[model samples]
Target: MTHTTLSTAQRDRAAGVLLGLACGDALGAGYEFGAPLPDHTPVRMQGGGGFGWAPGEWTDDTSMAIPLARAAAAGLDLRDETVLDGIVAQWVDWAKTAPDVGVQLRAVLSRTEPTASAVRQVAKAHHDRHGRSAGNGSLMRTAPVALAYLHDPAALAEAARLVSSLTHYEADAGDACVLWCLAIRHAVLEGELDLRIGLPALPADRRALWEGRFAVAETSRPADFARNGWVVEALQGAWSAIVTTPATDATHLRLALDAAVRGGRDTDTVAAIAGGLLGARWGASAVPAEWRRIVHGWPGLTAADLLRLGSSATPDLAHAQAESVDYAYLGDVSTLVRHPHDDGVWLGAAGALDALSAEIDAVVSLCRVGTKQVPTRIRHRVEVRLIDDDDPAKNPNLDVVLLDTVQVVAALRAEGHTVLLHCAQAQSRTPSVAALYAAVHRGVPIDRALAEVIAALPAAAPKRFLRDAVVRLAEANTDSPHQGPNTEGARA
Candidate 1:
């Protein structure tokens, strides 16, 4: 297992988790605690809603997932949320609609101190029912944690159970939680259905049923799988289709989605939730526009926005209520997006100037982002550019294209507008070195460049290697850092 970094798109794979989580929640939320599906949904299941639209909002399942994600962004362990209060503060300030919390979970979130509450409270809640209680809630919302701890399944299941305990207490319920995490783990690594991921972990009874279903090859003669009331059955059914359905086409996914929606009971939700696992594996192409359009709180955003948020290891969207992304550049205006999108954000002083020049009719917003242990800070600009022309560190084919970027605000004291600095989310030798030249040439005070970054960065060339990389970038860019301030200044 190589420890290489994930590419922008590869890292953004979890964007699917976000999208899938939200979509599943919104769609399933419509009918939470509703009447069971028709005794024989075969008829309605065969002819289902177009996008699982019953009032596509989200539920406790999805809502529960939000805290975990915010907790992750804050670097607080799920087992401990000393910083969760800050998250609660955000929720209190912006989230107008309260979540439809599960009975137990509602009580959990109702706690006054996020820090004091997230402790054993999460796991203890499910202790009595960890093995018996099985519900779709945990299975539905565990994707985010699964991706975050891809290398660790126990941690992933622990997160699912911890969260599930807040609301459910059943043996199968806990077991179901395990299946969902496995589904997501498989999705992240292969992005394709991987029955093996779950077969090893499912309970004997559930696993037996799943195997029974898998052994049955006829679509007409549905497998002996049970959809009675367990999360495992639904999850198993979904995964079965994912592996055998060969329905990667958006149309197929769309059709299957409608089938899930109208089948009523857990069937619709089962279909919708499982879709997240499958759709994520196949990528966005497998999801349909109709489903996205009808989903509640979707924010009507674009793929680019999703990708940008994905690169940063966080989804800064309407639900998250980001002050910066909350607004937009309507016309000739501009906005900036600054943050770490995995590999590490490479801030280019010179590239910032060039992007401003590129803005003939586009609106841009520049923002800043903090490092791993820091708080969330908005950068000023997020332009798309290659760090270096000849830096071999980049794989042109795999990088996130047309990135939403940010500026090195500190570089402003020197070149004002003309000064250039290069920054990237990918940690690459060429890109980091490229930043050196762009920073120095764009009048980035040489001392400031070294002091502000240099040693603090992993790729910052060792004193010996730093000189050549810096000189090379300087020689390539014609602009001088010491040059006069531009008419516009450095303000975005």
Candidate 2:
């Protein structure tokens, strides 16, 4: 498949696929195999399931998908047998030490040599012997297949089936993968959900069967699919959770995944499945920063790694490292001024990071910096991905990113850690975020906060778009009940 250039929205959605999947996997990890959760019960990544997952840690569902994501990111075709073999080899290595593995996948991997041909033979033999191999295992990790062939629906359908056949020979498993992958592709490209879009690509009989399944899902709730361990029911349960939930805004991504977890049995798999589509439709920007901050698992990967993998999977969307800036050319990089309302928070330019004081244990970076720019001694450091540009397209999740950054700063300060908030210069991004922090956390009016923040930073001049966003955030906060600054709570 040739690389297809993606729009900003398309790029964000493409990166969101794996992120959404991991977030859902971690969220549901603590509830796997449990009965349905009661309505209004708060769903958190508390982490106490059969596998003893750490809070916000993803499970085998994401672990199994990583190799495929890595391959796609490296620009390898998923339909190629050699690439599939490499994926199987990685899975074999992962299974040896994985905290948890699916029963069917374990049966095949444990007994066979780690080769595509050998693994397929063992999988076929297992299916033939028991007449049942349509487990949810294949479908759970099929999200990356969609990213590999987003430009061609026909190739996507073929690759989805071929990849699924590596460990699941059943037609049901392959069909479910094809439909779900096609749906994810559609969501990423078209910004909509349509499970039936790939129906015609399947055999006529199977197409009809899937159509009926979708019907059942649309009319019911995720909890209605009691046998979620099966591939068909897993798809139904995931789709039901998505369609049943009202996606009025980006928060729908979280709500739908929560609904999937509440569907009871095999909570992690179902939620992970739903998350792929939801993330594709909403973009990585739609995912909550709280989840992005903590979600990690398998092979020692973090949320940032997931974002990189997902972006790299789409060759055209591969992120280029930010160009290094000459700190010497920019005037006085050491301008550190205390926040007007909160003395514990210091506002400054990137140069201030050259010699951070011992009192500042936390740092919120608004500009891109080198790997070692932040001191190792700092206990908390959040590198916000806010670009120093006025173009709306440059910062798709401007509002969310801005608020989340302020919240992180406030949370850090509330925990009694002095915080440093800075950008490349003390100009656009830094002062804007600092002012936002004052408005929301310090309970100052938006205009007064901006004026105070400007007065503190002599060179402060926020761009039109960012300044507008601050005003909007302040208005929204004022319209609602004033919650204290630490709304998101301290980071783990």
Candidate 3:
């Protein structure tokens, strides 16, 4: 139970489960209430549905889980009155504007009750009136309970039911939450899911029931196993997709997620439930970078933001020192990368100068309008100042700035140093400079250079505001008698 006993693998899985849940939620966000995605259609996060979210934006599932995670990070027992009260308060706040809300959940929260008992009473009333109130509501947000109590299965199982009972009073809903939490915890602690770990925690009859259900699930298809509104069927659906998918390698992880999301109705919540366990089993690196860039949640929390929150809940999860990764190459010309590539200059955001320079010979820091000298650990530093606007129309000096950027990067590459051109998010300003650098120094046309950079960094979409400036810069470079013929040269 000590922090010293926690392993790196445990930490990554804990982080992975939460992040994976968000990734699935975001991925399936677009598919909600829509027709089934055709087989082989790439499942990128597009972000428009009944909720009308921006692409990569998670829905109610992750939004509701965030408060629970924050409470767990604060070290409150999830079953405690204070913790449950705080969680429901957050739910009420989120529900006020949430684009999607479960019928039972909305009915319960609408009563303005913040206590677990009050919520449970309301849920029980709904169940009595409606015959079946065992919605997937509780199971969708239960991943964080696994992380909070991962070191103790009995505590996790108990806590999972308590949280579930708040809005899903049915025993099936509570039981499903317990099983899913145990599965997530097992994956985090043992590097894979082993349902036996949770078997002893259930009552004798429920235990026998789940064991048989799981046995049957081994051969069940997702469509048949998981029904959106029923908690037990939802778990069955999630586990079936996971058990049947061939997640033996990176390709399989993608395949597994594809299978999960393609389940159709309520795809986001089900895939999110399945994804948390899958991510816990496979580790965070199993997720692709393009997806990682866009995964975000309500209240403007990004993937990195959620990762830090997950890390906070699990104290043993070691975080790299700010900007600990060294220089890395995003492309042959230097594009999207986590570490600065060796043997190159780094063109990065304002804060990235230190991390970039730590491993390289020099750095070019881009800013909106002015420059400043910064003390650094590395030997060399260059400051490039330009208007930060995305459009060329707003910045009269954009042509001059682009020309200067091209010259600076050309000078660095001529000296045999790799250069990282990075703006914040590396989506706009950085790639623009790199495209201009390619056009001027390598004699490539501006359009061709821009096309190549876009191809290399799929996520780094250059801002269109720079179009006029880029064309002018390309035209000026084309007219130059000194334009080089080495179009194949690397200078990103």
Candidate 4:
């Protein structure tokens, strides 16, 4: 428990990265419409318009990022119907409001653009029509794809190129997507800032290896220093800034903000994408909290919840869901451990499915304000919750819907005798309620039971995200705390 390499405090602090990215995103979002910033705050909005978005509201940038991640997490292949469907569905959500999506993207999404297939249709179209297009827009939202395919650089390139063509049909745009995806892949997985590794020098022959390519955008000229209108310039700018910056944790992030604020037509999006890449390099933790507190993602997707959710859900990944081992941190401890809850270690895909299903079942049951699970065989359902100290009426979205839980649990119980108990992470909060349930049904001691869990997972089981969630669970109960000698009182 007292490992010298990382203290509990350090572990908790490192867990802040994911939160950091969302904050940066939300904070920067304030200026997305080219809004003016008060002198006190940094200016991230510039150019023709302001983001007009409220704090925490992400634009097409972050929204598009998740499904790509989902697709990648599911498989490296963007061609997979599941992956493509996921991507198109997210885009469709955006099109619902801002229907005037970028040209190529709109066509692909509509499936009216004469695409031969999903894999390289967009890119090929650009090659055929635009002569050569390399737009930074393709690069901006490339992180999720990079993250999903962190293990496969070439695959990352292909996917990035494909998605890029959805909006941009030029080779430069395609290359921009490939290069930026490469950059983000390095940033997120390799903790790299330099473009030299996977993204070769621009206007170079790197594209020939994948497929014969040329950067023929009129906007790009060797002497023009590609800027404002050229995707290559923005892509290269991000690369240069990320690589050459002072290495201050958020330095690259700041530069990205700089890009968006003054970045003219595509300012905000470019800023968002650049910040994402930079944030990934900094492990998402380096983003400022002020910003993350404000950055908003949609109901099912967002920076705020994704990584944290990932922390727990990661352990529950189905076999087919994992891509590569990437990196594992025993939290703040310097030593590395095999990543648990990953598809890699689970004897391939089948083991993953079994584990994921089990984990989801545990989550569904354990965190229920209410839940539904068809418990096969003898089924035990446990629900634990802590009421908000301030208000009983207010509900955090994370809690399960009460009616749904009741319906499922009721039906299951009707099928057979069901074992169900609800407890908070802290025994005290859950105790009174648990005691009530115990009187009515089978129940276990709340306080004493969780203590054993803590002891068992002193190093291994309670990953940081899971541990924090437990703390929150205990917090909701507010009846007892996890610190000190009293931990064993419940005989747990």
Candidate 5:
């Protein structure tokens, strides 16, 4: 199936599929198979489940999905027999010594040859003997199938079933994959959560049945689905967590997944299932920087690898160029100045790294920099993906990225580390982010913060888009309850 070019919003949502999956998987890895926690309890990725997972480490749910994501990233048609066979081969290889594998999937994969046909036959025969093969295993890894056929719902439905059938032969399992994949596709394109959008794609006989299941999900809590090991209940549990949660913005993505994890048994699988759809709706920007910094899993992949794979899987995403930059024309790239509101923070261009004082122990980079741009001695270095362009489309998650970047700086400073914040030139991204940091963390008015920051850096001139975002964030912050640095008598 051919796909047309995607808008920036569409691209971000598309890239979020696997990213959200990994975040949910890792967050819930530590709490798997436990009873539901009391409401309002904090959920963290402090790993140590039945399988000893490291903090921020994903389990088999994401591990199983990686092969499909890799294939989609390679531009292969997911429904093609050759592609399916290759996916099966990868799964077989992964199961050899993987730390964790689902019981149903391990049974099917262990008995069959690595080929697609062999796996399908063995799966069907196993189902025939057991009279049931509707484990949630297949549904947990079905997120990537949506990325391959974002524009072709019919093909997506067919591919989802075919892929699920490779290890799960039950109709319920196939139907669940079809619904979830279609929901992900719709979420990516429309930025809304509507699972019923896929109902027409399912067989007419099964439409009402699934609709009723969705109705039950809406009325129930995630813990209501006690038999979550079954694919039907798993879908219900995931959907319940999503609908029951209230969100005013993209933070819904994190809160809903927290709801899923708190639902108890099979925590990782349920949360991973919800995360794919949440990521599709909110884009990668909605994910927290703290979580993105550490989430890693199978085959030695990090969050950045997942971002690349997700972006590559979607067609027509405009990637930023990695061409070498000429800093000589920009006059002085090394003009360093202390933040007007906080003495702990330093502001400058990328060139400021050349003569960093020993006091600067943390670095927050806003633009692309060389691998060795920051000194190795700086133990805490964060790279924020903020483009200098004024077009909103150029930076799809502009506001979220800005807020997250400043939060990173705030976090570093709260740890008592002096920080150096910089971009390519002190003109656009650097000044804008510095101003935001002052407004957010020092409790200074944004306009005053911008003026003070611009005064400190003679070359500072923020982009129109960034300036507008700063104003919006400042107004929003004023309305919300916030605790920042004690600025009672601090310098403006």
Candidate 6:
């Protein structure tokens, strides 16, 4: 692979914005309510804090930011209902089982409106019923908006405020979002922190309010900023940590993370806020490698995944393409490519028929995970829900269901039918099932079969969850006789 001419600092800050947020969130997870951490060594992701999250697992802060980052990366207009609807969908889905959710956020998310105006009304209603409406929930997840609009300072400010109104309509919450996003954008684009640049984006009345706050941030301890749920206090705590810590040393990010967690209240959010600025100033590489390896979130995104996502959010790197299918064979088994696996049967995208041979005897569709879509064009159609790892929690019988479909594929091959397994993209689902069939029915070892499958399909990468599921099923039935198939290796 060739490298882009982009500077190392540019790449680092780009990936840093999101990865930093996750690192801080995970690092502070276990210390949310505990005694303040010492400022000597940096905080680690030692799970079992107030939320009982696993080590390196982030919370709602990073989870809620994902859809926004994806939204900005796709260039969706934030003012549009479709864009807001996408954000709402991710929020609702996460809230379904989120271990922690703020009271006002819960009420606002409960309403099924996709418009910013509607969400604002819902938030106002919640505030009327409850006590306070302004919380750090909105600001905690606002860092991605900065990455999404890194080049345009004005647009970035506008988006930061608009997105905040989704659940936090208070002007201070919106102003905090604007200030933090501008700070992140500056750090990402200019490689330094300049909180003053966001002043023009804030409401004229609130300008004086933030000026005094910034002065306090420069000299105060993180504890003086208060780790409460209030948005102003959240920004104060996060910025105090950022400004007080020395950003010059090689371990500047570590010092900042330590300061944010030292307060011991709302540790995750405060650290997350500080992480964004620190990451923006330093770059993703500034975060400790040990912490990066373990940091993950509800979106199934590890720090590495988030780094890739953040880098992709850069405007010069963004591109749009129509879906195309590539054809290859996993040993004797044929493969068709898509996003998720297609149960090792021949399936093509809507316009990828050119690459796929029109002479296919059968097709198995495993797109959409749980919902099986039976094919009508092919003579023999096998439906299998070989879902990705993300869906396993929702569908517990995924392994058994996949095993049954593998047997069915073996049976079809024995009956002398050439087949193609396809999913939405054939990237993970289709290739995984193809490799599994090679291992189980064709007597190939799992590793060798996987190597062959990926080698044959250069575009395909292994999906560990699907592969493990298939391997577990294969190991369970290893002692049983192979009675379904007719050949030593069934050719698809």
Position 471, candidate 1: lDDT: 39
lDDT of candidate 4 over 1-492, digit per residue (tens): 011122222222222223333443444444443433322244532212253565456655556555555554444467455556556666666655652244445544555323324524655565567665555555555665555454567666777776766656676777666666676556544455545455453345654542221233222222123353467665543444344445553344554455344433444454555565665555433443334323556554443345433222122223212332221221321221111211111111111222233322221122222111223331233222223232322222112222223233334344443223222232223223222222222232334434443332223222223333344454444454445334552332
Report the poorest 10 consecutive residues by lDDT, candidate 1.
Answer: 397-406
By summed lDDT, which 10 consecutive residues of candidate 2 come out lowest? 483-492
Write model 1 residue lDDT over 1-492, tens digit each, in one string: 112144433343455555555555455445433443433343221222333344545444445455555455443445444444454444333233453333344444454344435523543554454544455555665555564456566666666665555445565666666667677677656645555566566556677765665555224211334452456666655554444444533334444444444334554446556655754564443333323334444233332333333333343322323323211122211222222221123333222322443312221212222221111231222223232334332322112221101123223323233222233221232234334533643455433443334433333332323334443444344354422222121111
- Give the Cα lDDT of each candidate: 0.42, 0.86, 0.69, 0.42, 0.86, 0.69
**Cα lDDT tens digits for candidate 6, 1-492:** 112233445656777888899989998888886666556645667998877899989988888988987876666666576688778877987887999887778878877555556777887777777766688999999998887776567777887887888788677888999999998888876777888889988778888989998898788878775545788888888888887887664367778888889877888999999898888887765666457646888877665457657776765544212132222222322334421223334434322333456556665555421211223355555434344555443333455456655666677667676666666555666667776777678776655555556555534654667656756666666643323322222223
- Model 5, 341-392: lDDT tens digits are 9999999988898899999998887876554567879867776767788776
What lDDT tens digits, residue by residue, belong to model 3 across residues 3-33? Answer: 2234555565566777888988888888886
Q: Count the backbone clashes (under 3 Å) in each candidate.
A: 55, 0, 16, 36, 0, 18
The local distance difference test score of model 4 is: 0.42
- lDDT digits (tens) for residues 309-414 of candidate 2: 8988877743333234457677877889999889999999988888888788888877766556778697466766787777776676778788888887877877
> Which of 3 and 6 is the better model by lDDT?
6
Q: How many steric clashes does model 2 contain?
A: 0
Top lDDT hit:
5
Off by over 4 Å in 1: 1-4, 28-56, 73-76, 79-132, 201-229, 240-244, 248-252, 298-311, 314-492
Ranking by TM-score: 2, 5, 3, 6, 4, 1
- At residue 319, give the lDDT of candidate 1: 36
RMSD of each: 14.8, 4.9, 13.4, 15.2, 4.2, 14.2
